[model samples]
Target: MRQEDIWDADTAARYDTPGTGMFAPDVVGPAVDRLAALAGGGRALEFAIGTGRVAVPLAARGVPVTGIELSQAMLQRLREKADEAAIPVVVGDMATATAPGEYTLVYLVYNTISNLLTQAEQVACFRNAARHLAPGGRFVIELEVPDLRRLPPGQPAVVFAAEPGYLGVDTFDVLQQHLVSHHFTFDPLITGDRQARVGRSPHRYIWPAELDLMGQLAGFDLESRHADWRGTEFTADSPGHVSVYRTAGKPVSSGP
Candidate 1:
């Protein structure tokens, strides 16, 4: 199925887990804090701003926010939280679509950029973010560093999350830098039976150095990188990173 189909209405309807999971205040609060600070009192733009997860709260912090999203279903979910005046969104591919007005901050969180699934598209995404950003503006991305080290020799899969009734695993193809995240949920039915649901999404994993090269190609300077939203130190041992890039000039196809 197409990536759009994978994030259909049904998926959007069940995407939020209020007060828990990704929606937990601890998770969302720090992210909003960091993004708001990066916005520096100027307008902000979110790429793949699904369901107003961070936008709504960031707006509550007084930043003018706009969004570009591919999934209409997810946009609908965002509308339920904030109207067009509060958070206007353009429906199209974030790598190519343009939203009105310049922004001091352009952000893609939760590893959404990986959803583009290819190197060219991901590079385009950085360029697009640069396009929307004002001079001196910043582009931030929260992404996991590929977890290939966690996989046992000759093994392609690694378990990342295991909760009471949910499991998250990632299978990798190092040759292609391809990853498919598999989610399995077990829910107890009214009849005391457990129902199982499975989901899989493909992503192209980029390493830190490769991400920096993409930024350079798009005329951005790597400003700072942290291990988390709280501004923890980033190290080789870190599982993920929050990278901040400042726009410097027009993108270039070839290095100088």
Candidate 2:
């Protein structure tokens, strides 16, 4: 499937449906709250803000939010949600999109950075976030910790059974730093009723140290890194990585 297919209107509609929106309140909401506190009461920008999942709630908390999204379909749903919640958004690619003004907080949550799929693109995303931040502003990122250890010896696929006759299979190509997932549904009685839907979401998993290096390269200081929204210690076994970086101040270069 093409990369653009992932953000089609059908997919956007499915995003908020039951079982699909499972991680929204539990994982995304708290993280937005944390980032809002770090913003110090100024405007905020969200990169790849699909469907306004976190952005709408953040705006509800009185933190002004502006979003940059790549897909018009996804942005349509975001605008629908924003209309319901009375928020505003911008449409563009997160890696290079620029907001109207500097923000105290800039964030990309839920592994959205992985959508970039390459080292160069992810680095450029970091630089873009740095450019949008006001002096001393913070850029927050939330992503799942890469689980390389899950891959079995001499095998490339890991199966996660979501329910009976439903499986989420992940294929990892370590050499290329890419991963693809297939969602399969099977018929209990007639095997021919089975169907497979493939989602080719490529990602370049970076370790926490690598992310820190990227932040430094973008002229930001690593202020804090947490394991989860509650601010737990970050370790190798942590399920998620939450990082906060402060933009370097005066005499330091700021880009357009």
lDDT of each: 0.90, 0.77
Cα lDDT of model 2 by residue, 1-256, tens digit: 4456677887787577532454446766677668778767788898988888788778888888888888888888777767733655667778887878878888988788878878888899999998898788888888877777888999998875577666787788888777776766566454565455444455677778778888889998888888987889998789788888888774222211
Model 1, residue 4: C-alpha shift (Å): 0.6
Candidate 1 lDDT trough over 10 residues, lowest sum: 247-256
Q: For each candidate, C-alpha RMSD in Å?
A: 4.2, 4.3
Highest-TM-score candidate? 1
Candidate 1, superposed: residue stretches over 4 Å from native: 190-195, 249-256
Per-model TM-score versus the true fold: 0.94, 0.88
lDDT of 1 by residue, 1-256 (tens): 5789989998899898889979999999999999888888889999999998999999999999999999999999998899999899999999999999888889999999999888999999999998888887889999999888789999999999999778999998999899899998887752135667888899999999999999999999998999999999999999999999987754311111
Predicted candidate 2: what Cα RMSD to the true structure? 4.3
- Compared with the true structure, the alpha-carbon lDDT of candidate 2 equals 0.77
TM-score of 1: 0.94
lDDT of 1 at 22: 95
